[model samples]
Target: MMRAILPTRALVPIAGLWRVTACMAGAALFLSACGATTGGPGVTPGPASPVVGAPPEPAVLGVEMSPERLAFTPPHLEGMDLVRVGVLLPFSGASAALRSEAGHLLRAAELALFERGIENVVLLPKDTEGTARGAEAAAEAAIADGADMIIGPLLAAEVRAVSGPARRSNIPVISFSTDTSVAGGGVYLLSFPPEEEVRRVVSYTAALGADRFAIVAPATPYGQLVSQAYRSAAAEFGGTVTAEEVYSGGVDSMSQAARRLARAGIGSLEVGRALAMTGEDWRPTDSGAFQVVMLPAGGDDLRMLAPSMLFADIDPLLVKFVGTGLWRNPDSAREPALANGWFAGPDAEMRARFETAYEIAFSEQPSRLAGLGYDAASLAVVMAASEGGIDRAVIEDPNGFLGVDGLFRLRADGTVERGLALYTIRRGQFEVLDPAPVRFGPDSMAVDVEPGES
Candidate 1:
């Protein structure tokens, strides 16, 4: 049996609908639902301003229920409508790390429910066990329990497995998979697609007069996707990829690929000699084969690749370095070769607030993907109380919705468009070069097809 935890005070409704507000650590975060617009900092309902020593207070909208207790059945409330949102995750899996990530996602979803203070919607969690078969079973169970919509089933394979069941039942699925192939029809991807990140970084670089570009990427599927995105984005920005290299195996292979890419872009021997003489302060007077080189690797691979570029005489000062969201790590900041490199990611300031709130709510740092859960659940809450309800048109609203991860909108094709910010690595830290756009414009909507999209 499930119990409804009623709010201590009644919420004052806005326009006959409950508005979502997250009061965190002395500040109020006003969030807009799909198709609605609010004014503020990064976009409308901008960066939250501090309320001068005020304590945190949860939003009072309606009754709240524990997700654990309402795992399968939601309690019936007389004269009140209930929206059942099925949350599919790999709660029980062979890999312990995946299971832990699943826990973080669930907790994040629950946090959104608590913060939004919406009692009309119930989150019904079902375990996928990290397999396609398990995902199908989970979807079946969730549907049987009268779920109006579904969230998650993380991997691309699991999303595909659940797609059929969800489509037949006319239930929309907001999955966490970055794979664009499974995105479209009734299933939407809420994950961060590398294509968008690549387009953002490339567009920013190109706008700064970088016409010639090069790339040294891994030979994996992820590498292929990013590499294709690089080509499309460069072309879209009126730039050309002059040199490209792919590598597999260990450090030696990566070094060789980096060497080949650097040598291909290196100027004449006289120029190299002059650069060597200038030492650490060297800046080439002439342009090389390419003005920018994109290294889409991160972590240890990035550490190795950066130095390898130096060994091949690829001066970071001469040729600009660019990367995707993978370069947004603290370790990447420490790499000397990546010091002036640029990358595109979410609004750092807003993301920091979310991290702080999550840590305080859950007593632990959330996984990188946990924001997806928070945003999805938050959207569900707003949609549940929406006059149009959780329909396809509302979910695919061109105006989009604003959440902890900045602003994002689900498209009819099931792809998502996010407002990203540009960051540069400098002095062992990541600094914002360009703030994320507060609102999406006509130009922002005109993006090229993703890797797997036709």
Candidate 2:
């Protein structure tokens, strides 16, 4: 029942059926290729051809992949065209945790083929081993194997390492790195960047007439990024960040920061508590030092931060609370202090369907990043079926494509923009306060202007 929101040309089928042949043993480079086909009644399966090559070495780029790990290759049919998609991930690494994550990403990509009913596309997974040199080697192997398009190489450093080889081969890459610096020149980032989330939520809050803002964030790198993004978003939306506080360390530091922020904005804790005692309603449009406070943490950090603000006597009823995509967790709704707090994220309904489908297919909950792999593979399928094939023009189409994470477009600059929905924590649930836009406007880039830019 899942339908794609794409142009008519993207749905057109390519001429000729194609099959994937098994990787021959003793090949120079060993790739675990996985191909999917849509079989129907009255269609006879074609015979598979043996891909003869040298046996695999003990290790490729210091990452060992045993034959047992490659045994999941599906049988292929002969005399069919092929659209080879090279998926580079840290399949083997010093960290076992990262290897597990890579497994989830690869599984998600494989799931996209069957779910989309794609018959001609084949997935060629290469192990990056979680290093720049490994990623460069993987990219070289994939390019040498005639990959039509490349997906992943998750880390920013890995993306940078793969970019040169991909450009030299005229192959486009859809990476999962959030670092905007690594984007552009045929490397499109499919990962969620904090800038877009901050922009959306801040714009929405400003539209509600909250002009004065305050921020309470941690001192981590992510917090710094979100803080900078918040400032830019606020200025662009005609709001002023009147006060800010950055804390490091544990819950005590966070609580102290919140208290400091409260004093800076509302004078004293006693006054804020006295103000809360009044049964009078406080609206965003009302004149005050600050009408909204931005908290960009998630999980346990969020659990502690939200209550810290409340304990500082910053009444949630009087001051609006805004956050980024990190607030999408169900646990955020369970926190009584966060009730009525607003955050921006993907379309809830679409994400719910995707999560359900992924859980059913994998028998476990998929990680938040798994959607990037699914969407990247889905893009490959659409491009392969299209008349234009997989190229920069087809990929950078202004119309964009809708996927599991909702509507998103790969910009010519290789940065991605997503249509997000505003949600509020309510009654132990996250409820959509503003639904996500179904499509991009004619001038989608108009809102992407940075602060202080003409």
TM-score of 1: 0.79
Residue-level lDDT of model 1, residues 277-365, one tens digit each, is 52223232447888778889899999888788888888777777889999988899999878878889987666665676667654579
Model 2 segments more than 4 A misplaced: 1-79, 267-282, 442-454
Worst 10 residues of 1 by lDDT: 37-46
Q: Model 2 RMSD to the real structure? A: 9.2
**What is candidate 2's lDDT per residue for 1-454, written digit by digit as tens?**
1125322222112111111111212121222231211110011112344223421222222223232212222244235566777788887767987787786786677656645456677666778889999888777766655577889989999999999989987899999999999999999999889999989988987887888899998898899999899889899999889989998977999999988888775632357664665322335745447788999899999999999998998877668888988888888889988888888998766666656666655567988888888889888887888788897887887767777778788899999999888888778888888898766876543222111100
Q: Clash pairs of candidate 1?
A: 39-45, 40-45, 40-46, 41-46, 42-438, 43-438, 63-119
Q: Number of clashes in model 2?
A: 9
Candidate that scores best on lDDT: 2
Per-candidate local distance difference test: 0.71, 0.72
lDDT of 1 at 116: 47
